[model samples]
Target: MEIKVIAFDADDTLWVNEPYFQNTEKKFCSLLEEFLPQHALSRELLKIEIENLPLYGYGIKGYILSMIEAALKVTDNNLTNEAIEKIIGYGKELLNEPIELLDNVEEVLQALQGPYRIVVATKGDLLDQERKLKKSGLSRYFHHIEIMSEKGEDDYLKLIKHLDILPNEFMMIGNSLKSDVIPVLNIGGHAIHVPYHTTWAHEQVEAKLDHENFRHVEHLKEVLGLMPV
Candidate 1:
């Protein structure tokens, strides 16, 4: 309730992100359908992504690399040049994808800008996050931007420290519970979950969450109701 600085997660929180990746995955499966079953190839790609997270981090480049690696593995070191081109093109296309702001994202940011210092605490490749922010035209709404390598309790803690605010004075709004909600609550901060339709497997949590500092809403516009107008 004492929240002062409100931090938001980038990706699905502010825009259409995961669905693009999901669609790309579908295309990837189709491209490789000749070599393996669609279900089997999907499973293999997921495994490769999980394994490469630490090595490649998170971004279209890493994702495409994983796809390429998965392709090579599934084909037993036999991958066609055309297939490789298609896979690489997928990544390039994603990188250039237009920034589609979620409904009411700009409106909410405008409403909260004066009363609170808004921040973006998102994890992904630094350059890509920056590029999207530039394209989004929402950069003017934020006081600070924290592109993190990962989002965990420690990362959130560091963010609050940088903002010179105590844990209870901070609130995080995002679409991922595992990345944005649980960690902030664990650190004694408020978290508001605005669920997106699609989530990456690595970001899913089985347990339902309930806590004093936690809140959930069906849309980004609902955030306006939670903040002082």
Candidate 2:
């Protein structure tokens, strides 16, 4: 079947997202090491953040706050006004960093724009995604941009229904195996997995090699070669 709608995953799929988090985590981890053992502190922070996912969702701002709260809780230290100020300063730095779009993302999207219906179906902070989209200068190619809090079976199902597109006629292209591939395949849609070099810890999932509807590619630009139009 000919593909009609081409959906994409934002964040690390098209740009540098997790790296920024990694950088922030490195800074946080260094400070944290002063109060707690590095390994213990890292594990505890992960536990706290994961536990708070329902409340915090995902983003730099929420993550920074969680780190601060975790430090206070784990050390039993009353967070000093000075330390709070440092955290706030780091948060501002994180927010101000420039968005980095991956190589060939703009070129590939622009090439495929006229022939197919392009859409960005990303899962992340609304403000962050919006900022990246606006700054990337590739937003014009997409007819639809969806900034979702989460990517699951229901989310994909709802998008399919809203777009009024058949499962067979749609393609979900993304770097995630769990969020992007499985959900699309579960809904009877075609999905292409472009394995990114670096994936967020939360977004990582075991790769399924035997899936019939799922295809893998080395790069985002490779999608154009697979399609007729």
Candidate 3:
């Protein structure tokens, strides 16, 4: 495969992301525990979050709204302003969370920087993603950064076109099989799935994918072995 552009997913793939969200979620669930059990509250929050995706897109800000909405729904709109403020505070904390680079992330970027056009292709709020990239200090390795609202085939097609590269000449490395791997493969590009320890329920898919241009690696550094020398 003549892969010219190598796009890496920012969250979880290059740095710690989901766990911070999960931590915030636990705080959220506990805050509303009087109205509902932790497990049920988690489900309600997840439901509201998924429902609000179309309107709010994906980000800490959306999550804060969802938490507030969930609290109101579960409490029959009896939620106090203090609780809502706390929810917003949780989101702010999440936004300020430090960027913890994953193991071998920098090393892998250093190794691939010269041979390929490296870029960040991820889905999240533009400002937040940019903040994380800036905090990560690995921004210099990337030739471009594409923070997408969605990772659908059409979205990726547009990105490939913007990069002036054919689908076959592009490759995506990410943690989500649903967003990062399947869509890229469907668009006739290469994909490598380096799964994180946890994944959002909405991003989970149940399919045994078998494709010629697909690979599953246990670690980010292993991608070096799969690259064409």
lDDT of 3 at 111: 91
Per-residue lDDT of 94-114 in model 3, one digit per residue for the tens? Answer: 999988999999989999999
Per-model CA lDDT versus the true structure: 0.92, 0.81, 0.93
Query: Which sequence of candidate numbers ranks them by TM-score, best first?
Result: 3, 1, 2
For every candidate in turn, the CA RMSD to the true structure comes to 0.9, 1.5, 0.8
State TM-scores per candidate.
Answer: 0.98, 0.94, 0.98
Top candidate (TM-score): 3
| Candidate achieving higher TM-score, 2 or 3 | 3
Looking at model 2, the pairs that clash are: none
Q: Return the TM-score for candidate 1, rounded to 2 decimals.
A: 0.98
Q: Model 1: runs farther than 4 Å from truth?
A: none
Q: Candidate 1, residues 68-108: lDDT per residue as tens digits?
A: 99999999989999999999999998999899999999889
Q: Roughly what TM-score does model 3 have, to 2 decimal places? A: 0.98
